[model samples]
Target: MTDRNRRFLLKARPNGMPKTSDFALVEEALPDLQPGQFLIRNHYASLDPAIRGWLDDAPSYMPPVALGDPVRASTVGVVAESKAEGFKAGDWVMGLNAIEEYSMAQAGGFSQLIDIGNVSSPTHFLSVMGAVGLTAYFGVTEILKPEAGQTMLVSGAAGAVGSLVGQLGKQAGCRVIGIAGGPAKCARLTDDYGFDAAIDYRGKSAEALSDEIGAAAPKGIDLVFENVGGIGLDATLLHLNRFARVALCGLISEYNSEHYGARNLWQLIVHSATVRGFLISEFLDRFAEGAAAMAKLVGEGRLRFDEHIEEGIDNALPAFLRLFEGSNQGKMILKLI
Candidate 1:
């Protein structure tokens, strides 16, 4: 093992959008391993939109990232050393390993072993078998419960969570419409992910988008996988059919802003709609079911996934910002090794 560990440290609190300047890289000596402890070499770190929420000092579902902490990140790694029972050297695992070259993880903190026999790659532990896939599964099955032949719309459609949600909607026999930023993303949603229709948000304004979505779902929308708040939510609200259900996932559009102005929620009352916010953490026990279903679909060619990987850990900040800029085409990940 190396004498010094290299890791990304949270240097300062972000006021708006976080930049590379907000983080600092530091080298420190590794501490002696205690009982029931293990050391790991990180391979890939998952960059998620929810990380922005973790940077703020607010009361949320999870605690904020403390100053000088190794900027919390979910990573897949191989164990290098262990003093813990049931774990040994060369064991591949997934856990909250922080953004570091090496980390000492407590035995009980994390130990989700990767089943490479079924999955295509290790990073699937962070995408299809991780929180992203579970978020999509629960958001579609429990919240939306879309009926066959009904129409469903998804915002942030090409993203990790939204892309899976669109596929699950299709599997349920719903006509799925995806809203992404560019033609490339839109095309991938339709051609690769099996979405029924794709709307390029960058090509037209929100007002102009209303007609396109309306034409696609002429009977009005039965379900909305809301990954973006603000204007996207407003547009979906305008087309919600009576008894329409909306699963409110992450709101990427409003994450960096100081104030996210309210939209016309009265449309919900007029249309008799229901919107519910969800977090995957609340349904952790059901992860096995979600993973099994996703794996089965993938094995049958009924569902597909893509990863937009940026090489090296140094590219994390730039790659993460791509979510807001509409630059990433699929699940964005940073290869740390």
Candidate 2:
């Protein structure tokens, strides 16, 4: 373990897409571990869009990252120092840590030990079997429960959670339609991920996208696993069938937008459809159950997910910006080691 730590701190709250000026890189001495505290040498930091929301000094599920504090993120690492029982040096763990070379965590907190024997890769804990997996699982099975023969729409269908959600919808016997940005991703949605149909939402207005959605779901949308909101969601809302269920997961499109223009909310009232905002944290107690189910599927080769890993801590800001730029190939991860 190094005597010092490198951190990507929030220097300023961004007005739109974050830039280098919004952050500051600093090196600081690692402090002595106190009783009940354990130090982890982070191997990889998960770069999720949710972290973007945390940068704003607005109301959210978690507090915004304080200026000069290391940006909050989920990281997988090996314990390097432990003053706590049930944790030891070399033990692999994952937790809501920070974008840094090392993070200090406490026992009985959000951090949990990982069974490397069962995991295909430690990074999988940050992808298919971790928060992303749980988000797709509970967001589908628990929240937007789909019935056989129903039509399900997944926005950001090529994303980490969206990809898994599409496959699960298929397994549940719903005809799944995916909305991605490009022809390449749209093609993979059907060819690789088994989505019944794929809609490319790029370079299209809300009306144009809605027309495509109508053609894709001629029977009307019975369920929506929405990730990218704004026009994408507004378009989807226009096709909601009576009593439709929408698992409102994210609004990535509006994250960097100064003007939030979602104009089709009246569709909800028109169709009596339900939209429930989903946060995986709500199902924290059942995370193990969700992880086991997803792991089994991955083990049997029934699940397919992707990871777009960018190497080095120095590239953290650029790597994170790829998420909003729609350039990441899969789950965004920063490999520090």
User: Evaluated with TM-score, which candidate comes out highest?
Assistant: 2
Per-residue lDDT value at 39 in model 1: 88
Per-residue lDDT over 151-211 for candidate 1, one digit per residue giving the tens place of the 0 to 100 score: 9999999988999999999989999999988788888899889999999877576688888
TM-scores for every predicted model: 0.96, 0.98
Candidate 2's residue-wise lDDT over 258-300, tens digit each? 6466788888899998989978989988999999999999999
Q: Cα RMSDs of all predictions? A: 1.5, 0.9
Any runs in candidate 2 off by more than 4 Å, and if so which?
none
How accurate locally, in lDDT, is each candidate? 0.85, 0.94
Instruction: Candidate 1: list runs displaced more than 4 Å.
Output: none
Lowest-lDDT window of 10 residues in candidate 2?
A: 257-266
Q: What lDDT is reached at residue 294 by model 1?
A: 78
